[model samples]
Each structure stands twice: as C-alpha cells, then as structure tokens.
Target: PWLPLEDDRVRRLVEARGPKEWPKLAVAFNETLDEKDQRTSKHIRDRWTNHLDPNVNRDPFTVAEIEIIRGAQRRMPNEWTKIAALLPGRTDTQVTNFWTNTIKKLARRALK
Candidate 1:
C-alpha cells in the first residue's frame, strides 16, 4: 500500500500542515485516487520520511546489502532505522519487511 507522496495534492497538504495532518491528508489523497482509505497516519509518515525523497531510488537489495542487513540484525535486532542506515538507499520499512518476510523465513527453513 504505497502512497505517491510526491503527488501534488498530497505534497501540498503535507507541506501546509506537516505529518500531523496525515490522516486527513490520506483520506483526501485516497479520494482523489478513487481508492479506499486503508492507510493510517503512521503509514503516510513512514513513506514521507523514507521513500518520498526525489533523490532516492527504490531498488531491490543486492547480496551485499542482504549481508549488511544480517549483520545489523545481529547487532541492533529490531532497530529498523539503524539497520536501514547501514544499508544506503534503503528505508526502515523495506529493511524491516525484508527481515521479517525473507530473512526469518530462510532462518526457519535452515533450522529444520
């Protein structure tokens, strides 16, 4: 459920009121998209903080990036922001989801 935070309407609302108004903005944005409002303020804030930057590209992780994430997981556990910082160009949500869905599944399979 990715929001295009860069959308003009969404961006304007966010710029006008900041992250605190995300719930209202989400509804408005969803309405414009003709989509249901399934996102919460936290979801909007996370996208705004991590993925909304025009300079950042959303690319899949490389093997090296995965290894870095593994090491960071051992050191920082569930500290997603710290783990994301270790992997340049990645976001906390991306790192966290990767760990939860990919790494954890691999670990579980290996344990069997």
Candidate 2:
C-alpha cells in the first residue's frame, strides 16, 4: 500500500525548493518511471504534502487540539485549511476527516 522508495528524494527536493516547483519535480520524477507508472503533478504533490511530509503529525489528537479544532470550525465553517492553520502538525485533510468522523458524530450523539 506504500511506495516509499522515492519519498526521501521527493522530501529533499520539496525541502530545497518548496512545493511551488512540484510540477517540474513531477515531470522529472515521471522521466525516471515506466510509462505505466507515471503519475500526475497533482497526485505527486498531494501524496508528498498530505502523507509523506515529515512535518505531518500522525499521532492521536490531544484534548487541547480537539478544542482548538472545534473553536476554529465554528469561526470558519467548512474551511478546513484555515482551521488546520491553528493546529500545528495537522493537515487540512486530517482536520476535516477528524471533524466529520469523530467530533461531529459525538456532537450528534450528545444532542440525542
């Protein structure tokens, strides 16, 4: 389920130049792959930023983090990215998923 062999190189490139060069980096990466395995720039960037970036926190959310997320969501409804900005180590996808899957469900149950 993981293709981590090229992750180190991807991380180095992104760290050196940032995500702005992701398209060019993707092209270069595709050049080294077989045609059947070629990936789109968006796919490459999303994979690195969302899953492979070392800065991303895979740990369980703490109580404080959940409170922060709740407060931020109330201020900026579906704006996951803005909410995520207030919580270090959390990606927008992670924030959105946690809110939709955990927090919202708990709230619904509490109200019932």
The candidate scoring highest on lDDT is 2
TM-score of candidate 1 against the unseen true structure: 0.58
**C-alpha RMSD values across all candidates:** 4.7, 2.5
Q: How accurate locally, in lDDT, is each candidate?
A: 0.72, 0.84
Which stretches of model 2 miss by more than 4 angstroms?
107-112
Residue by residue across 38-57, what tens digits does model 1's lDDT show?
Answer: 55566667667665645454
TM-score, per-candidate, Cα-based: 0.58, 0.81
Worst 10 residues of 2 by lDDT: 1-10
Q: Report the lDDT tens digits of candidate 2 across residue range 1-49.
A: 3377667767777787787777898887788789988777887788887
Candidate 1's C-alpha runs over 4 A off are: 1-6, 13-43, 49-51, 107-112
**Native RMSD of candidate 1 (Å):** 4.7
